[model samples]
Target: MPRAYEEIADERQHGRDTHVRRPRARVVRDSGRHQWEKDRARRPPAVRAATGATERDTGLLPDDLVFSARYRTIEAPGELAEAFGVCEGTALLERSYRTRYAAETAPFSLVTSYLPHALAAANPDLLDVSREPWPGGTHHQLSTVGIEIDRVEERVSARPPTPQETRELELPAGTAVILVRKTSYDTRGRIVDVSDVVLPGDRTELFFTTRLERW
Candidate 1:
């Protein structure tokens, strides 16, 4: 268990409800992040375009804005490997990131992405951490080796931020977070990538739209 959760568990042992805390910030709803309507899944190009547009719309450009990425590959945890339908010891490419507006001291969010080593090794670029923020994003990179993404799946849940997460997001005390696990599948139904995003609940809103066909 994460230390933060451990702390909460310890507190629970003493008899206390942790849900009474109020959030202290707000992040605009991410339509792209939460939407599944019309198969409007988020791709790499869209990510860059959205981020760039956001910076532009906010009156900041190359001179005043910057985006940074830090990543690496690590052995997949048992559960993570299971998510990829692989054995426990499989190696997976892991990329950790922190994106932020230059003027702000805190990052916009914390993201960690993973790709199975066997799949990514097909294209050397995928294994090279320095290749990011790959001009087109993961979708384009995968396309280099003839992989076509057919769909995306996202599972969302909420929990109190861990000590590490709280410090990284610069979240205030009593703030919980929204946890998003996004999975990408290829035309062959193979899980190509999985990304975990941690969004500050106080600063984030989720929206979904569903359309029903006319009978």
Candidate 2:
């Protein structure tokens, strides 16, 4: 009986030792860094590229103004002012026009603006109209022209086109209008001019080209 009791006590001790030596369950607290890393990894690479540097570093070009006069006669002076969002009486000078072959069948129109003709002409370098690299924005271009741009006022309106405008300008379906008004000032603190631009969104593709030079 004594030997049996001793053997039973030794068995119980071995069982207790085995339980103590077994691995405990570990609880890892979440810190949220793993989830954040996962979310960042899922975003598009272009978003990361654009956010990584300034315009100069990324070699992006300035905005190009694209105009189409396919269906209209020469735009009137007042109409030009209305289109550009400038004040009334701002003169509209026809800078240049060319008939270019887009594809074999579709021949599109091209029009360029000498913006300084309406406003006061600054120095040559200030009004350089060549295809040089520039930042992509209207305000940025106006800044290069020596015009003190205050703010951009946008107005969108749609109306049935007049018989003449519709026939000449070639109105299409869903042909509403977009007007961007740019208010600028001169060195004398006087409101120099306001420019408004009208665009037919379907046919016009504004091309902005920028080339970055080596440091």
Candidate 1 lDDT, 1-215, residue by residue in tens: 33453555466678776664332223453435322221222344555444442342233454444567776668889889889998887888888876565434466678888988878889887887777656446666677788877788889999999999898888878989899898988899999899998988766667666577999
lDDT of each: 0.68, 0.35
Error of 1 at 210 (Å): 1.7
Q: What lDDT score is found at residue 153 in candidate 1?
A: 88
Can you list the residue pairs that collide in candidate 1? 25-202, 26-203, 27-203
Once fitted onto the true fold, the runs of candidate 2 whose alpha carbons sit more than 4 angstroms away are: 1-120, 136-138, 145-147, 161-174, 180-182, 185-189, 199-215
**Residue-wise lDDT of candidate 2 within 97-150, one digit each (tens)?**
222211111212222333434342443432343522222223334455555443
**Quick one: RMSD of model 2?**
27.4
| Whole-structure CA lDDT of model 1 | 0.68
* lDDT, candidate 2, at 2: 37
TM-score result, candidate 2: 0.33
